[model samples]
Target: MSSRRLVVMRHAKAEQDGPTDFERPLASRGRRDAEAAGAWLASQGVAPDHALVSAALRTQQTWESVASGAGWTLSPDFDRGLYAAGPESALDIVRLVPDSASVLVVIGHNPTMAVLAQLLDDGSADAEVGASMAGDFPTSAVAVFSYDGAWADLGEGTARLEAFHVGRA
Candidate 1:
């Protein structure tokens, strides 16, 4: 069976002076970091067939930078629901993904992003990577998982945490 790849990433750093939290844009460092993240994913051979990104400005910008750095030409769906979605809600959105997409990427905000990575880990892979991820999920942190089942079948502890990376530029 051809396994599926799920790339879960937190939005890059953002300026704190936006008109509202949802409207905050990525800072200069965040853009560079996200681009670096994209390059890292590319190096790891992560070619996403689809991208689900939050409608928040920071996330959108992060997706753009990542795409540019990775040299990908795919467009992402801007989702307002993902903006404030917790890990469960985010997983719900992921479950709605089309099966044709063998590789999927989700860009969202914190707590949820970090927590979702932990929740999906099956603990059958690299323990050190899991430990590092458990410590902190800073800006541009990413967790890649390998799942043998369909997207609909994905759930807590169903996927193996393949890799963890933090992009810095």
Candidate 2:
């Protein structure tokens, strides 16, 4: 089976407003961090085939900044299900990715994203990064995992954390 690459990230900081959480805007720091994350990916020569983004305003804006900074031209799929969705929902979204895509990116919230990275980590790679991930998956942090199996077959402890990155713009 071909190896698969998954990049999971939580949306950056957002303004604390009460109008509605879904409409919360990304804070200035969040915008900077998101752009820095994109630049970091570009520096690392990372190009994901597809991006499954959360439909919330903050998440969408996060992907927008990241894509612009990274020079990614691919259209992203924004899904409402990802807004406040748990790890299981996130996994379900990933499972829907076409097999033709070798690399996939997921941008959403946490502790779902954070916990999912921990739960899915096989610990066979990037042990140190995985360990740090346990403490905090701060805003704009990105975790890369390599899984061997169909997306449908991904389960707990089935993927190995390959790399983790956090940057400033």
Candidate 3:
């Protein structure tokens, strides 16, 4: 099985007031933080070949800023399911990714993102990283994992947490 890298990120801070939750836009701080997140991922040598992003306005803007900051030129699939997804639903979406993608990025909302990160972890990776993730998975936070199996086989305790970061700018 090929070693695959999964970069899971929570969308950056969004304005509290909007026409609807799905229509909310990223705040200025969110844009800056997301850019920083992208830069950080790039410094860590994470280059995603495929990206799954929520179709929400905030998520779309976050992805755009992240891609710009990372100097990556690619389009991501704006998945509507991710907008209302829980941890399990998000995992199901990931399972659909083709084996050809060695590195994948998923950007979406929290709770789901945090829970998914926790669920995927096998507790065999860096203790500090795991602990940090457990404490708080705030906006702009990212969890990177490495899995040595097919995407279809990804489940609870199937991945090793490699890194965790929260972008603030």
Output the number of the TM-score-best candidate: 3
Model 3 clash tally, residue pairs? 0
Superposed model 3: Cα runs more than 4 Å off? none
Give the local distance difference test score of model 1.
Answer: 0.94
Please report the TM-score between candidate 3 and the true structure: 0.98
Each candidate's lDDT (Cα)? Answer: 0.94, 0.86, 0.95
Inter-residue clash pairs, candidate 2? none
State the number of backbone clashes in model 1. 0
Better of 1 and 2 by TM-score: 1
Error of 1 at 37 (Å): 0.4
- Pick by TM-score: 2 or 3, better one: 3
lDDT of 3 by residue, 1-169 (tens): 7799999999999999899999999999999999999999999999999999999999999999999889999899999999999999999999999899999999999899999999999999888888899898999999999999889889999999999999888
lDDT of 2: 0.86
Candidate 2: RMSD to truth:
1.3
Each candidate structure's TM-score, on Cα atoms with residue i matched to residue i, is 0.98, 0.94, 0.98
- lDDT by residue (tens digit), candidate 2, 1-169: 8888888898887899836999999998889999889888877777989899999999999998898878898789999999968998888888888888888889999888897888788878765776777778988989888888888888899998888887567
Worst 10 residues of 3 by lDDT: 125-134
